[model samples]
Target: MSTTTPPTHPQRAGLHRILIVGGGAGGLELATRLANTVGRRGLSEVTLVDRYPTHFWKPLLHEAASGHRDPASHHIEYAALARRHGFHFVQGELEALDRSECLATVGPILDLNGNDVLPRRLLRYDSLVLAVGSVTNFFNVPGAERYALPLENVKHAEEFRQKLLTACIRANHLREAGAALPEPTVNINVIGAGATGVELSAALRNAINLLSTYRLNSLEPERDVRVRLIEGGPRILPALDQRVSAQTHARLAGLHVDVLTATPVSEVRADSIVTVTGTELASDITVWAAGVAGPPLLKALDGVELNRQGQVLVDKTLQTLSDPRIFAFGDCAACPSSIVGVFLPPRAQVAHQQAVYLSQSFLRRLTGKRVDRFTFRDAGTVVSLGRAGALYQGDFGLGLRSLIVGGRAASGLYAFVYRRHLFALAGLTRMAIETVSQWLRARIRPSIKLH
Candidate 1:
């Protein structure tokens, strides 16, 4: 394997340097696990590198975009996590990779004014893990990248929320002054009926309702606010069970959300979206959640085998085919499934399971023990539908084929998924404290963010 000293922080002798790129759910969890175990025992040197200083669960990006959740209160500081756990944190974007030299170059950090803040640096690793995750794919649609907003990161989510607020306020002013408005109402078009699209559509409806209730805007939630969820597929949540999809569809309908299926968005204009069937839909704000592709850096990496979707191709052990020393998981890796012939689905649960597997694999490797192939356990799926509740479709390990539930029970199960993630990152005590804190905050603060 290629070997080199880190240009900035030289690796000490004997310690196996484990450098993980990306601080997403999988990378962060793996780093924490290794830090608490092998890292704490001085068996390996673990470091996590990410572009952002904080991490908020990607599943909650919809809530952030709809202003239903305050990101500041929920985000975990990377530095803080590193300090609490036994790992190092590096904040920078991955720029280039030199597989032969075993060096990964991080681009220079710049300020908002384009001034250089930190020079480019090289990081060397005995083993490298790429969990950089995926970004929105516009499918070569004309004007899509420029006109539609993508909820991929915190900045994007915040920007979408601000834009939504601005649109609502502007619409409210036009109505109040009785001016000839461009449209009689605010139209929001969400492309994609996947989990993200469906959840965001529901959250937006609830947000609009709350805003109208507080008299924050002059637009009526039931009349002047129109949310249309357009999907190219035959039905919403195509990856999920049909029962869950139907239940979620019903919940969205109850919330006054327009569900349009089998209609593909051909082009996204600044003020409207055109379907493949030559139909134009009015839109004040458009959100793109149709599909995801791996980060651009993955395709640029030399020698790394990638799938058609640009995801790094890995074996069941999550090791890259080109280099066993390099690994990838999460949404960035296309790991083959042992059960089905297809690759594993890109879901938070899949990443969580991989993280757990990798952590143990590292331990076994360090001890010169046999590392078993990774096996994915089918734990079912849950789709949240805002205040209308959620839909749960999973076997729950009862050896049953499937069990479907909705309403409050499903909502509780949906929450448990996130809570379980929290339990993994933080222990029971911290998770409890966070749960109580959020509950108390909900009691006092506004249900939605106004600013």
Candidate 2:
């Protein structure tokens, strides 16, 4: 009897091309795992495509904005990592997908000098995964989109920092010369009651204070600098226990950081964010940290069932119901688990756990073994409210306040989160060396970026 090895892709002459789209948390880790098997072993050619040329853990963007992190020094360049990990890195916004034909078009790459780096190219893949992640949900508040910056990535945070500094310096100069002070200038208004909004508001306030001390002697940062966090919800960090939110509220209040819950902004402007109560919170900087929605591109894909928000709906095995040949997970995917009742919410925990599940599932497929259903382990929430410190949760759904830590201890643990991520990717030996090196570098130089 003769047996045949099935071709990976019908169009492929022989080679199997496995393309994983999006370099976000789940996508990147999945690519790495598969690369160790397929790419390193030469059974498959793995390619990771993303709009950005590098990858930064999405959770730390606020700290990057606060001058606590240097993106240039910390981010992992996708090109470098791909080369080291036995995968190909391709940078392009996904233009179109032809699932039936197993074809994808990655187009129109240009160089800094306006030369064509790579022309419109077609890729063939036997299997595909979508992990494009998500963006903030502005909820269509009047003028919000036109005015506020959203904390989408490190670039967005860096842009906000630069603009905020310029506003501060210009205002200070005008005040020193006895000119009329700029009204509604340099005040930052952040919308949303979630963790990102709360933490970013606090981080920005701290950064503004530090900026004033180092570069703006002419400006009274304490008096002139203002941060208003407006949330439609009754309290900040509503996802966490009431005690966590209350303690965070107190810490922020002690810093004179304005926290207004249940007060929704009716309008936003280039220079101010106006509340429904008719209070014009003068702001030169506004941030939309509200909520998240899936990318709109997923709706165009053939045979992929998507929710109203464009989230690819998947089964407990993390396989898309419409076509099991493709799988979508992470923030961009609505992976439903039996335990969660509804779709699993997009959190770092969700993404991390999903990656592990997907990797194992793929391994099981190759070995002809059974795949386990994904179970979301709800480990409490942690909210970092800048120098005011942090909050840790206890019990998954009981919402217990029995276990809590904040201040210096909480801050240290907050730093540990990113360290743990790096450890997972690079192993303990590499992460330990990196931790020591970063500490030494900080001691040798000024802690904050002067520019």
Name model 2 segments beyond 4 Å from true.
Answer: 1-16, 38-43, 112-115, 179-185, 337-341, 397-402
Off by over 4 Å in 1: 1-6, 180-184, 339-341, 395-401
Across 1-451, the per-residue lDDT of candidate 2 in tens digits comes to 1122222223324446778889987788888878777556556677888888888999888878777778887778888878777788778766777888887766556788866666666667777888989987778888877778888898898988787777788887887888765443457777886888888877877777777778777777667777778888899887777888898888877766789998888998888788888888777788888888888767667678888777888888877887777888899888775555577777887888888877777766655688888888866567787767888875545544457777787777778877977776666898899889888988986666667
Cα deviation of 173, candidate 1, in Å: 1.8
The residue-level lDDT of candidate 2 at 71 comes to 82
Backbone collisions counted per model = 0, 0
Pairs that collide, model 2: none
Best by TM-score: 1
Model 1 scores a C-alpha lDDT of: 0.88
Q: Please provide, for model 1 over 1-451, each residue's C-alpha lDDT reduced to its tens digit, 9 standing for 90 to 100.
A: 2222346655567888899999999999999999988887778999999989999999999999999899999999999989999798888888788888888887776788876677677888889999998999999999899999998999999999998888888777788988776544789999999999999999999998887777555687777788999999999999887878888888899999999999998999989999999999998899999999889988778899998889999998899999999999999999998556589888999999999999999988987899999989978788888888888888656666578878799889888988888888888999999999999999999999987
What TM-score, computed on C-alpha atoms, does each candidate reach? 0.96, 0.91
User: What CA RMSD would you report for each candidate?
Assistant: 2.8, 5.1
